[model samples]
Target: MWVFWALLAAISAALVIVLTKAGLKNIDSSLAFAIQSVMILVITWGVVFFQGNFHEWRAIEKNAWVFLIAAGVFTTLSTLFSYKALSQGPASVVVTLERSSLVIAIILSVIFLKEKLTWQVIVGGSVMIAGAVLISLSNSRD
Candidate 1:
């Protein structure tokens, strides 16, 4: 089930890249992101209410709220930066670079979350970073 959700997320993220790139033509990236952010907030909360999940907000702990808020801040920055990049660069290259944050997340989890790192994780992350670097360098010819 988790794998299914992860695959769905990957598909949706790819669409977001292409759609956002197309929609950003001649538009200010920050303003474009603001509009999308509003839509995201509204739709997410609407679904929460529809699913009777709004009540779960009351049971959320203060620590959970704190972390979630912090995560939201990072996510906003990430989206803004990525949106700006998408507007300025090729979608394939930019999205590849953006998705390389997976490497950072793995390292951060090992450090901050005290997660154990296996050989597979280290090797996989290194390979992903290498791929991102390759994509980033793709159109840079003299």
Candidate 2:
């Protein structure tokens, strides 16, 4: 069940990126982001309410809330940067760099969460970063 949910989440995220790129062609990215943030927050809170989990917010640890708030701020700033990138760069290259958040996330996890640094992770992250650079270069060549 978890695997199914994870797969669906991945698919939905891909669709979101593609749709965001297409939508940005016709609208102000800031306005789009504002609307998306409101819609997502409402929908997320609705789910929490439906699951009778809204009350659980009171039980959330202070450290968790701190992390969540920091994450939310980071997400907003990241999206703005991404929108700027999409506006200036080809969608293919912009999308590739945006998705490189995985590599960034791994590095953050190692630093903040104290995750072990394995050779596989370093190699994989390096390759993914290289791919982003290559995609950007390819766009310039076209």
Quick one: best TM-score, which candidate?
Answer: 1
Q: After superposition on all CA atoms, how large is the RMSD of candidate 1?
A: 1.2
Candidate 2 residue-wise lDDT, 10-127, digit = tens:
9997787777878888788888788788989999998988998787888999999999999899989998888767766777888898889999899999999999999999999999
Q: What stretches of model 1 exceed 4 Å from their correct place?
A: none
* lDDT values, one for every candidate: 0.92, 0.86
Per-candidate TM equals 0.95, 0.89
Writing each residue's lDDT as its tens digit, candidate 1 over 1-142 gives 9999999999999999999999999999999999998999899999988898787888999999999999999999999999999898899888888889999999899999999999999899999999988877875541
Q: Give the number of the best model, judged by lDDT.
A: 1
Model 2: which residue pairs collide? none
Q: What residue pairs clash in candidate 1, if any at all?
A: none
